[model samples]
Target: MEDRSVRRQLSLLQTSFLLIYIYRNDSCRSTQFASTEGTTSARLPPVSKFGTVKVSGNSMLPAYRDGDSLFVSWVDGASALSAVGKSIIGKAVVIEREERPGIFLVKRVKNFQDGNYWVEGDGPGSTDSRTWGWVKPDEIIGVVLFRYKKAKPLVSE
Candidate 1:
């Protein structure tokens, strides 16, 4: 009886994990617009509009803390400047750090001038436009839609 109970619990746990994984992956896929070489326009047929990214630092502070996950609406470089010709000032955005390739950072859009953007963090210690100067449109990955906090695991005593 004890062995059977343990097996049932394990099976239940596995099923729970599988369901969560599927849901999470489904929510994470976002639309991506790839620009053609030498062209300032994005290719057609955009996929889903939403995506997820995890925060890794305190740069955003009160607005977004470390370990928080954000759901964003992706905006590709060519589309941001051409297709969506609206101002993004004061909006939180995910940007690919110019100095450190492959690393992404969350910052607020502070200024826009001559087709470039200046971003800053709410936290004073953040490394942003003050350190790296203006960010090109191509560096912006997505606009933050909402933040999701990680759920704490339940402890069974």
Candidate 2:
């Protein structure tokens, strides 16, 4: 999955509100940039909720490296709780870490059982459910639909 080609292709899907800034550390303060500011012309299907996630670590390496930008379809606490294992299982999600409160973590949903979601990072030695245990559905912020890594040069037709 080292190919940045897939990221370049998916980067075409976008929306105004989906623009976001990347951070290099857990600290929220950092230089900001808009993902949709002339990089893409694609449009997201008219949906009520959508947002972006910027990778600052290698936890999801291979599928999503550091600096990769992900366009997510946001699912609020209420909707996520009701959906349970139906919509989120087997999908990559941005979740509010219960331990860190406002901090968010991106991981793939591995399973749902006993009112909790088993999420894990794609890379070995990555910290996730293996260390924190299952996450509540309400903790899930969104599900990833498309990714755009800025480092990948877009291929013009």
Candidate 3:
């Protein structure tokens, strides 16, 4: 009876995890997301906005601290291509790692060469295009719009 109970609990836990995974992936790939404070863009509609992603490491240390959630939006290649020298250069973006499927990294755009982008993190600890070489546009998820950080005290006495 105890073994059966344990098995049931495990099944429920697995189901919960699966659901969460699906939801996260769906939100990441699609432009749609819940109407949340940090997720929505002030100037654009939610449908044409970026998804939120939480920082997990110190790669972007000074620019972005760990645990800070940022709004990342998919880039419109048409518009970017229309304007030369304005595709993704000098922008911070969230890119999908080609080496490891489903893994995403947030880095700044250094340059554009051929049809690929050179991305690097603000901090020296980052292992970005410097190590992986150029990243294809398809691998880039979107540009980071803004960061949502906890507000500091209004009057720190």
**Candidate with the greatest TM-score versus the true structure:** 1
Q: Per-residue lDDT of 1-157 in model 2, one digit per residue for the tens?
A: 6566665545644322123322221133322111211122222322345555566677777788767778677777556556556566777887776566545677889987887888898878778889889888777767888886454344586
Worst 10 contiguous positions by lDDT, candidate 3: 34-43
Which lDDT values do the candidates have, in the order given? 0.67, 0.63, 0.63
Please give the lDDT score for candidate 1: 0.67
Model 1: clashing residue pairs?
none
Q: For residues 1-157, what per-residue lDDT tens digits would candidate 3 score against the true structure?
A: 9997796777667666645644665654542322111233122322434466677677776888777777676665435433544456877777765576455678888998777788888887578888889887766656888886533323322
TM-score of each: 0.65, 0.64, 0.60
TM-score pick, better of 1 and 2: 1
Q: Write the per-residue lDDT of candidate 1 for residues 1-157, one digit (tens) a residue.
A: 9997796787668667645753755555432211111112222322445566667767788888776778677777656655553467888887775565555678989888877888888887788889889998888878888875544454454
* Model 1 residue-pair collision total: 0
> In model 1, which runs have C-alpha deviations exceeding 4 angstroms?
1-47, 83-86, 150-157
Greater-TM-score candidate between 1 and 3? 1
lDDT of 2: 0.63
| Deviation in Å, model 3, residue 133 alpha carbon | 0.3
